[model samples]
Target: MRKSDYRKLGGIVILLVLWWLLAYALNRHFLFPSPFAVGKVMLCQLQNTAFYQAIIMTLSRCVIGFVISYGTALVLALVTGHMKWLRDYLAPLITLLKSVPNISFILLILIWFNREISVMIIVFFVLFPSFYSSFTNGFDAIDQSLREVMILYPQSLWRQIVKVELPLLKPYLAASYESGIGLAFKVGVMAEILGQVPDGIGKKLQWSYLNIEMAEVFAWTIWLIILLVLLEHGLRLLWKKRKE
Candidate 1:
Protein backbone atom coordinates (compact mmCIF):
# COMPACT_ATOMS: atom_id res chain seq x y z
CA MET A 1 0.00 0.00 0.00
CA ARG A 2 1.02 3.58 -0.54
CA LYS A 3 2.27 5.49 2.52
CA SER A 4 -0.81 7.69 2.63
CA ASP A 5 -3.05 4.64 2.53
CA TYR A 6 -1.08 2.99 5.30
CA ARG A 7 -1.29 6.15 7.41
CA LYS A 8 -5.07 6.32 6.97
CA LEU A 9 -5.41 2.64 7.88
CA GLY A 10 -3.26 3.15 10.94
CA GLY A 11 -5.36 6.10 12.05
CA ILE A 12 -8.56 4.11 11.64
CA VAL A 13 -7.06 1.25 13.66
CA ILE A 14 -6.05 3.62 16.45
CA LEU A 15 -9.52 5.17 16.51
CA LEU A 16 -11.16 1.75 16.66
CA VAL A 17 -8.91 0.69 19.49
CA LEU A 18 -9.71 3.84 21.44
CA TRP A 19 -13.44 3.33 20.84
CA TRP A 20 -13.24 -0.24 22.11
CA LEU A 21 -11.44 0.84 25.23
CA LEU A 22 -13.95 3.62 25.94
CA ALA A 23 -16.91 1.30 25.51
CA TYR A 24 -15.32 -1.30 27.77
CA ALA A 25 -14.57 1.30 30.41
CA LEU A 26 -18.07 2.69 30.30
CA ASN A 27 -19.53 -0.83 30.73
CA ARG A 28 -22.99 0.47 30.17
CA HIS A 29 -24.57 -0.29 26.84
CA PHE A 30 -27.37 2.16 27.48
CA LEU A 31 -24.92 5.00 27.63
CA PHE A 32 -22.18 3.79 25.32
CA PRO A 33 -22.66 0.88 22.93
CA SER A 34 -19.64 -0.68 21.27
CA PRO A 35 -18.83 0.41 17.74
CA PHE A 36 -19.52 -3.09 16.44
CA ALA A 37 -23.03 -3.07 17.88
CA VAL A 38 -23.70 0.36 16.39
CA GLY A 39 -22.33 -0.85 13.07
CA LYS A 40 -24.64 -3.84 13.13
CA VAL A 41 -27.63 -1.63 13.81
CA MET A 42 -26.56 0.68 10.98
CA LEU A 43 -26.32 -2.27 8.60
CA CYS A 44 -29.79 -3.43 9.58
CA GLN A 45 -31.22 0.03 9.17
CA LEU A 46 -29.64 0.32 5.70
CA GLN A 47 -31.76 -2.63 4.63
CA ASN A 48 -34.94 -1.05 5.99
CA THR A 49 -37.11 1.18 3.82
CA ALA A 50 -38.18 3.27 6.80
CA PHE A 51 -34.59 4.44 7.35
CA TYR A 52 -34.28 5.72 3.78
CA GLN A 53 -37.67 7.41 3.93
CA ALA A 54 -36.80 9.13 7.19
CA ILE A 55 -33.49 10.30 5.71
CA ILE A 56 -35.25 11.68 2.64
CA MET A 57 -37.83 13.55 4.71
CA THR A 58 -35.17 15.11 6.91
CA LEU A 59 -33.01 16.04 3.92
CA SER A 60 -35.96 17.71 2.18
CA ARG A 61 -36.71 19.92 5.16
CA CYS A 62 -33.05 20.82 5.65
CA VAL A 63 -32.39 21.54 1.96
CA ILE A 64 -35.49 23.67 1.55
CA GLY A 65 -34.76 25.71 4.67
CA PHE A 66 -31.10 26.14 3.69
CA VAL A 67 -31.82 27.26 0.12
CA ILE A 68 -34.52 29.72 1.12
CA SER A 69 -32.49 31.23 3.96
CA TYR A 70 -29.26 31.38 1.93
CA GLY A 71 -30.79 32.96 -1.19
CA THR A 72 -32.74 35.53 0.76
CA ALA A 73 -29.74 36.44 2.87
CA LEU A 74 -27.45 36.77 -0.17
CA VAL A 75 -29.78 39.18 -1.97
CA LEU A 76 -30.55 41.24 1.09
CA ALA A 77 -26.90 41.41 2.07
CA LEU A 78 -25.90 42.71 -1.33
CA VAL A 79 -28.58 45.38 -1.28
CA THR A 80 -28.12 46.46 2.32
CA GLY A 81 -24.33 46.33 2.36
CA HIS A 82 -24.04 48.98 -0.36
CA MET A 83 -26.70 51.17 1.24
CA LYS A 84 -25.59 52.65 4.57
CA TRP A 85 -29.11 53.58 5.65
CA LEU A 86 -30.47 50.11 4.92
CA ARG A 87 -27.55 48.56 6.78
CA ASP A 88 -28.27 50.74 9.81
CA TYR A 89 -31.96 49.79 9.72
CA LEU A 90 -31.16 46.08 9.46
CA ALA A 91 -28.48 46.03 12.15
CA PRO A 92 -30.73 45.76 15.19
CA LEU A 93 -32.95 43.09 13.66
CA ILE A 94 -29.96 40.97 12.70
CA THR A 95 -28.51 41.40 16.16
CA LEU A 96 -31.82 40.40 17.74
CA LEU A 97 -32.14 37.26 15.66
CA LYS A 98 -28.54 36.31 16.31
CA SER A 99 -28.92 36.94 20.04
CA VAL A 100 -32.12 34.95 20.53
CA PRO A 101 -31.78 31.27 21.34
CA ASN A 102 -33.07 28.95 18.59
CA ILE A 103 -35.36 27.08 20.95
CA SER A 104 -37.15 30.29 21.88
CA PHE A 105 -38.53 30.33 18.34
CA ILE A 106 -39.72 26.74 18.65
CA LEU A 107 -42.67 27.44 20.93
CA LEU A 108 -43.81 30.34 18.77
CA ILE A 109 -43.50 28.22 15.64
CA LEU A 110 -45.30 25.29 17.21
CA ILE A 111 -48.19 27.60 18.08
CA TRP A 112 -48.22 29.60 14.84
CA PHE A 113 -47.26 26.91 12.32
CA ASN A 114 -47.92 23.25 11.79
CA ARG A 115 -45.48 20.69 13.17
CA GLU A 116 -44.29 20.03 9.62
CA ILE A 117 -43.51 23.69 9.09
CA SER A 118 -41.78 24.20 12.42
CA VAL A 119 -38.47 22.76 11.27
CA MET A 120 -38.37 25.00 8.21
CA ILE A 121 -39.24 28.10 10.20
CA ILE A 122 -36.75 27.44 12.95
CA VAL A 123 -33.93 26.61 10.55
CA PHE A 124 -34.55 29.72 8.47
CA PHE A 125 -34.62 32.01 11.48
CA VAL A 126 -31.43 30.49 12.84
CA LEU A 127 -29.57 30.42 9.53
CA PHE A 128 -30.42 33.70 7.80
CA PRO A 129 -28.62 36.20 10.00
CA SER A 130 -25.34 34.26 9.99
CA PHE A 131 -25.35 33.98 6.21
CA TYR A 132 -26.34 37.60 5.83
CA SER A 133 -23.56 38.82 8.06
CA SER A 134 -20.98 36.65 6.34
CA PHE A 135 -21.97 37.91 2.90
CA THR A 136 -22.04 41.56 3.93
CA ASN A 137 -18.65 41.12 5.54
CA GLY A 138 -17.40 39.71 2.26
CA PHE A 139 -18.79 42.70 0.42
CA ASP A 140 -17.18 45.07 2.90
CA ALA A 141 -13.83 43.31 2.55
CA ILE A 142 -13.57 44.35 -1.13
CA ASP A 143 -10.84 46.96 -1.51
CA GLN A 144 -12.11 50.38 -2.62
CA SER A 145 -8.78 50.88 -4.42
CA LEU A 146 -9.65 48.13 -6.90
CA ARG A 147 -13.08 49.65 -7.59
CA GLU A 148 -11.40 53.00 -8.24
CA VAL A 149 -9.01 51.36 -10.73
CA MET A 150 -11.99 49.71 -12.51
CA ILE A 151 -13.78 53.07 -12.57
CA LEU A 152 -10.64 54.74 -14.00
CA TYR A 153 -10.99 52.36 -16.97
CA PRO A 154 -14.76 53.18 -17.10
CA GLN A 155 -15.90 49.60 -16.42
CA SER A 156 -19.61 48.88 -16.39
CA LEU A 157 -21.33 47.74 -13.20
CA TRP A 158 -21.93 44.30 -14.75
CA ARG A 159 -18.27 43.92 -15.68
CA GLN A 160 -17.06 45.03 -12.25
CA ILE A 161 -19.48 42.68 -10.50
CA VAL A 162 -18.55 39.75 -12.68
CA LYS A 163 -14.77 40.16 -12.91
CA VAL A 164 -14.12 41.56 -9.44
CA GLU A 165 -16.87 41.22 -6.83
CA LEU A 166 -17.97 37.66 -7.54
CA PRO A 167 -14.44 36.26 -7.61
CA LEU A 168 -13.50 38.13 -4.43
CA LEU A 169 -16.59 36.94 -2.58
CA LYS A 170 -16.41 33.34 -3.77
CA PRO A 171 -14.37 32.11 -0.80
CA TYR A 172 -16.58 33.90 1.71
CA LEU A 173 -19.69 32.58 -0.02
CA ALA A 174 -18.31 29.03 0.11
CA ALA A 175 -17.50 29.37 3.79
CA SER A 176 -20.94 30.76 4.56
CA TYR A 177 -22.65 27.96 2.66
CA GLU A 178 -20.51 25.35 4.37
CA SER A 179 -21.23 26.77 7.80
CA GLY A 180 -24.92 27.48 7.26
CA ILE A 181 -25.96 24.29 5.49
CA GLY A 182 -24.81 21.94 8.23
CA LEU A 183 -26.16 24.22 10.94
CA ALA A 184 -29.53 24.29 9.19
CA PHE A 185 -29.62 20.51 9.06
CA LYS A 186 -28.70 20.16 12.69
CA VAL A 187 -31.06 22.81 14.02
CA GLY A 188 -33.85 21.68 11.68
CA VAL A 189 -33.61 18.06 12.80
CA MET A 190 -33.60 19.12 16.44
CA ALA A 191 -36.73 21.15 15.82
CA GLU A 192 -38.34 18.19 14.12
CA ILE A 193 -37.52 15.93 17.02
CA LEU A 194 -38.82 18.45 19.50
CA GLY A 195 -41.94 19.01 17.40
CA GLN A 196 -42.37 15.28 16.70
CA VAL A 197 -42.72 15.68 12.94
CA PRO A 198 -43.54 12.39 11.21
CA ASP A 199 -41.32 10.49 8.77
CA GLY A 200 -38.04 12.11 9.78
CA ILE A 201 -34.80 10.81 11.24
CA GLY A 202 -35.51 12.93 14.29
CA LYS A 203 -38.79 11.10 14.78
CA LYS A 204 -36.95 7.80 14.51
CA LEU A 205 -34.38 9.01 16.98
CA GLN A 206 -37.10 10.03 19.39
CA TRP A 207 -38.73 6.64 19.04
CA SER A 208 -35.44 4.93 19.70
CA TYR A 209 -34.99 7.05 22.80
CA LEU A 210 -38.46 6.17 24.06
CA ASN A 211 -37.88 2.46 23.46
CA ILE A 212 -34.43 2.68 25.08
CA GLU A 213 -32.76 1.32 21.97
CA MET A 214 -29.38 2.83 22.66
CA ALA A 215 -27.65 0.94 19.87
CA GLU A 216 -30.14 2.22 17.31
CA VAL A 217 -29.78 5.74 18.69
CA PHE A 218 -26.03 5.51 18.30
CA ALA A 219 -26.52 4.10 14.80
CA TRP A 220 -28.72 7.02 13.84
CA THR A 221 -26.16 9.50 15.23
CA ILE A 222 -23.43 7.74 13.26
CA TRP A 223 -25.48 8.10 10.09
CA LEU A 224 -25.98 11.80 10.79
CA ILE A 225 -22.25 12.33 11.23
CA ILE A 226 -21.56 10.37 8.04
CA LEU A 227 -24.09 12.44 6.10
CA LEU A 228 -22.59 15.69 7.43
CA VAL A 229 -19.07 14.65 6.47
CA LEU A 230 -20.21 13.67 2.97
CA LEU A 231 -22.14 16.91 2.54
CA GLU A 232 -19.27 19.12 3.72
CA HIS A 233 -16.68 17.41 1.51
CA GLY A 234 -19.00 17.45 -1.51
CA LEU A 235 -19.68 21.17 -1.11
CA ARG A 236 -15.99 21.97 -0.65
CA LEU A 237 -15.12 19.97 -3.80
CA LEU A 238 -17.74 21.80 -5.85
CA TRP A 239 -16.54 25.19 -4.61
CA LYS A 240 -12.94 24.27 -5.38
CA LYS A 241 -13.92 23.34 -8.94
CA ARG A 242 -15.70 26.66 -9.39
CA LYS A 243 -12.69 28.55 -8.03
CA GLU A 244 -10.38 26.75 -10.46
Candidate 2:
Protein backbone atom coordinates (compact mmCIF):
# COMPACT_ATOMS: atom_id res chain seq x y z
CA MET A 1 0.00 0.00 0.00
CA ARG A 2 1.05 3.60 -0.51
CA LYS A 3 2.19 5.69 2.49
CA SER A 4 -0.93 7.83 2.49
CA ASP A 5 -3.23 4.79 2.28
CA TYR A 6 -1.47 3.21 5.24
CA ARG A 7 -1.76 6.42 7.25
CA LYS A 8 -5.50 6.61 6.52
CA LEU A 9 -5.93 2.97 7.49
CA GLY A 10 -4.07 3.59 10.75
CA GLY A 11 -6.31 6.55 11.52
CA ILE A 12 -9.42 4.45 10.91
CA VAL A 13 -8.05 1.74 13.17
CA ILE A 14 -7.49 4.28 15.95
CA LEU A 15 -11.02 5.66 15.54
CA LEU A 16 -12.54 2.18 15.70
CA VAL A 17 -10.52 1.34 18.82
CA LEU A 18 -11.76 4.53 20.48
CA TRP A 19 -15.33 3.73 19.53
CA TRP A 20 -15.01 0.24 21.01
CA LEU A 21 -13.57 1.69 24.21
CA LEU A 22 -16.40 4.22 24.53
CA ALA A 23 -19.01 1.53 23.98
CA TYR A 24 -17.34 -0.65 26.64
CA ALA A 25 -17.45 2.21 29.09
CA LEU A 26 -21.09 2.92 28.45
CA ASN A 27 -22.14 -0.70 29.29
CA ARG A 28 -25.53 -0.02 27.73
CA HIS A 29 -26.24 -1.82 24.50
CA PHE A 30 -29.66 -0.24 24.03
CA LEU A 31 -28.32 3.28 24.17
CA PHE A 32 -25.14 2.67 22.19
CA PRO A 33 -24.24 -0.71 20.79
CA SER A 34 -20.66 -1.82 20.43
CA PRO A 35 -19.05 -1.93 17.01
CA PHE A 36 -18.88 -5.71 17.26
CA ALA A 37 -22.60 -5.91 17.89
CA VAL A 38 -23.28 -3.65 14.97
CA GLY A 39 -21.06 -5.74 12.72
CA LYS A 40 -22.90 -8.89 13.74
CA VAL A 41 -26.26 -7.30 13.02
CA MET A 42 -25.02 -6.05 9.70
CA LEU A 43 -23.91 -9.54 8.74
CA CYS A 44 -27.35 -10.88 9.59
CA GLN A 45 -28.99 -8.06 7.68
CA LEU A 46 -27.00 -9.08 4.61
CA GLN A 47 -28.99 -12.31 4.51
CA ASN A 48 -32.34 -10.57 4.64
CA THR A 49 -34.25 -10.00 1.39
CA ALA A 50 -35.86 -6.84 2.70
CA PHE A 51 -32.49 -5.26 3.44
CA TYR A 52 -31.33 -5.89 -0.13
CA GLN A 53 -34.55 -4.48 -1.51
CA ALA A 54 -34.26 -1.37 0.63
CA ILE A 55 -30.69 -0.73 -0.49
CA ILE A 56 -31.62 -1.20 -4.14
CA MET A 57 -34.63 1.08 -3.89
CA THR A 58 -32.59 3.78 -2.20
CA LEU A 59 -29.82 3.52 -4.77
CA SER A 60 -32.24 3.64 -7.70
CA ARG A 61 -33.88 6.80 -6.38
CA CYS A 62 -30.49 8.42 -5.81
CA VAL A 63 -29.37 7.59 -9.35
CA ILE A 64 -32.53 8.95 -10.93
CA GLY A 65 -32.34 12.13 -8.89
CA PHE A 66 -28.67 12.63 -9.65
CA VAL A 67 -29.07 12.16 -13.41
CA ILE A 68 -32.05 14.48 -13.61
CA SER A 69 -30.29 17.08 -11.53
CA TYR A 70 -27.22 16.96 -13.76
CA GLY A 71 -29.26 17.27 -16.96
CA THR A 72 -31.26 20.25 -15.62
CA ALA A 73 -28.11 21.92 -14.33
CA LEU A 74 -26.39 21.49 -17.68
CA VAL A 75 -29.25 23.16 -19.54
CA LEU A 76 -29.51 25.99 -17.03
CA ALA A 77 -25.76 26.56 -17.02
CA LEU A 78 -25.75 26.80 -20.81
CA VAL A 79 -28.49 29.44 -20.72
CA THR A 80 -27.52 31.46 -17.65
CA GLY A 81 -23.84 31.28 -18.49
CA HIS A 82 -24.46 33.40 -21.56
CA MET A 83 -27.15 35.68 -20.17
CA LYS A 84 -26.41 38.00 -17.25
CA TRP A 85 -30.05 39.00 -16.82
CA LEU A 86 -31.16 35.38 -16.44
CA ARG A 87 -28.49 34.86 -13.81
CA ASP A 88 -29.73 37.90 -11.93
CA TYR A 89 -33.30 36.66 -12.01
CA LEU A 90 -32.41 33.21 -10.70
CA ALA A 91 -30.03 34.33 -7.92
CA PRO A 92 -32.72 34.90 -5.28
CA LEU A 93 -34.38 31.52 -5.96
CA ILE A 94 -31.10 29.70 -5.63
CA THR A 95 -30.34 31.57 -2.41
CA LEU A 96 -33.75 30.61 -1.03
CA LEU A 97 -33.24 26.99 -2.01
CA LYS A 98 -29.90 26.98 -0.19
CA SER A 99 -31.26 28.79 2.85
CA VAL A 100 -34.67 27.17 3.40
CA PRO A 101 -34.87 24.17 5.73
CA ASN A 102 -35.02 20.83 3.89
CA ILE A 103 -37.75 19.48 6.12
CA SER A 104 -39.95 22.47 5.31
CA PHE A 105 -39.58 21.73 1.61
CA ILE A 106 -40.19 18.01 2.12
CA LEU A 107 -43.35 18.63 4.10
CA LEU A 108 -44.71 20.95 1.45
CA ILE A 109 -43.61 18.65 -1.33
CA LEU A 110 -45.41 15.68 0.22
CA ILE A 111 -48.66 17.59 -0.07
CA TRP A 112 -48.15 17.81 -3.82
CA PHE A 113 -46.29 14.61 -4.75
CA ASN A 114 -46.29 11.01 -3.58
CA ARG A 115 -43.76 9.97 -0.94
CA GLU A 116 -41.70 7.91 -3.40
CA ILE A 117 -41.18 10.70 -5.94
CA SER A 118 -40.83 13.40 -3.30
CA VAL A 119 -37.46 12.06 -2.23
CA MET A 120 -36.19 12.29 -5.82
CA ILE A 121 -37.53 15.84 -6.20
CA ILE A 122 -35.97 16.94 -2.91
CA VAL A 123 -32.55 15.61 -3.89
CA PHE A 124 -32.71 17.25 -7.32
CA PHE A 125 -33.81 20.71 -6.19
CA VAL A 126 -31.51 20.76 -3.16
CA LEU A 127 -28.45 19.90 -5.26
CA PHE A 128 -29.37 21.67 -8.51
CA PRO A 129 -28.36 25.20 -7.59
CA SER A 130 -24.91 24.25 -6.32
CA PHE A 131 -24.02 22.30 -9.46
CA TYR A 132 -25.67 24.81 -11.81
CA SER A 133 -23.60 27.65 -10.44
CA SER A 134 -20.45 25.56 -10.58
CA PHE A 135 -21.01 24.64 -14.24
CA THR A 136 -21.87 28.25 -15.10
CA ASN A 137 -18.64 29.41 -13.48
CA GLY A 138 -16.73 26.89 -15.55
CA PHE A 139 -18.44 28.12 -18.71
CA ASP A 140 -17.82 31.78 -17.82
CA ALA A 141 -14.13 31.14 -17.21
CA ILE A 142 -13.34 30.11 -20.82
CA ASP A 143 -11.08 32.42 -22.85
CA GLN A 144 -13.27 35.05 -24.56
CA SER A 145 -11.26 34.97 -27.78
CA LEU A 146 -11.54 31.19 -28.02
CA ARG A 147 -15.31 31.40 -27.49
CA GLU A 148 -15.65 33.95 -30.32
CA VAL A 149 -13.61 31.72 -32.59
CA MET A 150 -15.71 28.68 -31.76
CA ILE A 151 -18.88 30.67 -32.49
CA LEU A 152 -17.56 31.62 -35.91
CA TYR A 153 -16.90 28.00 -36.90
CA PRO A 154 -19.27 26.67 -39.61
CA GLN A 155 -19.52 23.23 -37.94
CA SER A 156 -22.73 21.98 -36.29
CA LEU A 157 -23.71 23.00 -32.69
CA TRP A 158 -23.67 19.41 -31.47
CA ARG A 159 -20.15 18.98 -32.86
CA GLN A 160 -19.05 22.12 -31.09
CA ILE A 161 -20.63 21.00 -27.81
CA VAL A 162 -18.99 17.58 -28.00
CA LYS A 163 -15.56 18.76 -29.19
CA VAL A 164 -15.18 22.07 -27.45
CA GLU A 165 -17.43 22.62 -24.41
CA LEU A 166 -17.25 19.09 -23.09
CA PRO A 167 -13.47 19.01 -23.18
CA LEU A 168 -13.28 22.32 -21.35
CA LEU A 169 -16.11 21.46 -18.95
CA LYS A 170 -14.73 18.02 -18.04
CA PRO A 171 -12.60 19.16 -15.12
CA TYR A 172 -15.44 21.07 -13.49
CA LEU A 173 -17.85 18.18 -14.03
CA ALA A 174 -15.37 15.72 -12.60
CA ALA A 175 -14.81 17.91 -9.57
CA SER A 176 -18.55 18.20 -8.99
CA TYR A 177 -19.12 14.47 -9.38
CA GLU A 178 -16.33 13.60 -6.96
CA SER A 179 -17.45 16.09 -4.29
CA GLY A 180 -21.22 16.18 -4.70
CA ILE A 181 -22.22 12.50 -4.87
CA GLY A 182 -21.80 11.87 -1.15
CA LEU A 183 -23.74 14.96 -0.15
CA ALA A 184 -26.48 14.17 -2.66
CA PHE A 185 -26.76 10.58 -1.47
CA LYS A 186 -26.97 11.53 2.19
CA VAL A 187 -29.54 14.21 1.49
CA GLY A 188 -31.53 11.83 -0.69
CA VAL A 189 -31.73 9.32 2.15
CA MET A 190 -32.82 12.04 4.56
CA ALA A 191 -35.54 13.05 2.14
CA GLU A 192 -36.76 9.46 1.98
CA ILE A 193 -36.86 9.35 5.78
CA LEU A 194 -38.86 12.56 5.94
CA GLY A 195 -41.16 11.41 3.18
CA GLN A 196 -41.50 7.91 4.73
CA VAL A 197 -40.99 6.24 1.37
CA PRO A 198 -41.60 2.51 1.52
CA ASP A 199 -39.03 -0.14 0.58
CA GLY A 200 -36.13 2.24 1.11
CA ILE A 201 -33.15 2.33 3.48
CA GLY A 202 -34.45 5.51 5.06
CA LYS A 203 -37.79 3.93 5.87
CA LYS A 204 -36.00 0.95 7.38
CA LEU A 205 -33.95 3.34 9.48
CA GLN A 206 -37.08 5.07 10.67
CA TRP A 207 -38.64 1.74 11.64
CA SER A 208 -35.51 0.71 13.47
CA TYR A 209 -35.32 4.01 15.32
CA LEU A 210 -38.93 3.91 16.49
CA ASN A 211 -38.43 0.31 17.72
CA ILE A 212 -35.24 1.35 19.55
CA GLU A 213 -33.06 -1.04 17.59
CA MET A 214 -29.83 0.74 18.32
CA ALA A 215 -27.68 -2.09 17.00
CA GLU A 216 -29.54 -2.10 13.73
CA VAL A 217 -29.28 1.69 13.56
CA PHE A 218 -25.52 1.44 13.97
CA ALA A 219 -25.39 -1.31 11.37
CA TRP A 220 -27.29 0.81 8.83
CA THR A 221 -25.12 3.83 9.52
CA ILE A 222 -22.02 1.72 8.95
CA TRP A 223 -23.51 0.42 5.71
CA LEU A 224 -24.14 3.96 4.54
CA ILE A 225 -20.51 4.95 5.12
CA ILE A 226 -19.30 1.84 3.31
CA LEU A 227 -21.69 2.41 0.43
CA LEU A 228 -20.60 6.02 -0.02
CA VAL A 229 -16.92 5.13 0.05
CA LEU A 230 -17.37 2.31 -2.44
CA LEU A 231 -19.36 4.50 -4.82
CA GLU A 232 -16.79 7.32 -4.68
CA HIS A 233 -13.96 4.89 -5.40
CA GLY A 234 -15.89 3.24 -8.21
CA LEU A 235 -16.54 6.59 -9.87
CA ARG A 236 -12.87 7.53 -9.64
CA LEU A 237 -11.87 4.25 -11.24
CA LEU A 238 -14.40 4.63 -14.05
CA TRP A 239 -13.30 8.21 -14.66
CA LYS A 240 -9.68 7.09 -14.91
CA LYS A 241 -10.61 4.35 -17.37
CA ARG A 242 -12.61 6.79 -19.49
CA LYS A 243 -9.74 9.25 -19.61
CA GLU A 244 -7.38 6.47 -20.69
Candidate 2: pairs in clash = none
lDDT of 2 by residue, 3-65 (tens): 999999999999889999999999998989988999899999999999999999999988788
Tens-digit lDDT string for candidate 1 (1-244): 8999899889989988898899999899777889988889999999999999999999999888888999899888777865779999999999999999888987778778999878888888999999999989999998989768877887776676678777898988889888887788789878888899999989999999999999999888889878887988899899878868
Pairs with steric clashes in candidate 1? none
Candidate 2 residue runs with Cα over 4 Å from true position: 83-85, 151-154
Worst 10 residues of 2 by lDDT: 153-162
Q: At residue 113, what lDDT does model 2 achieve?
A: 96
TM-scores of all predicted structures: 0.92, 0.92
The lDDT of each candidate is: 0.87, 0.86
Which stretches of candidate 1 lie above 4 Å from their native place? 1-12, 154-158
Candidate 1: residue 224 lDDT (0-100):
86
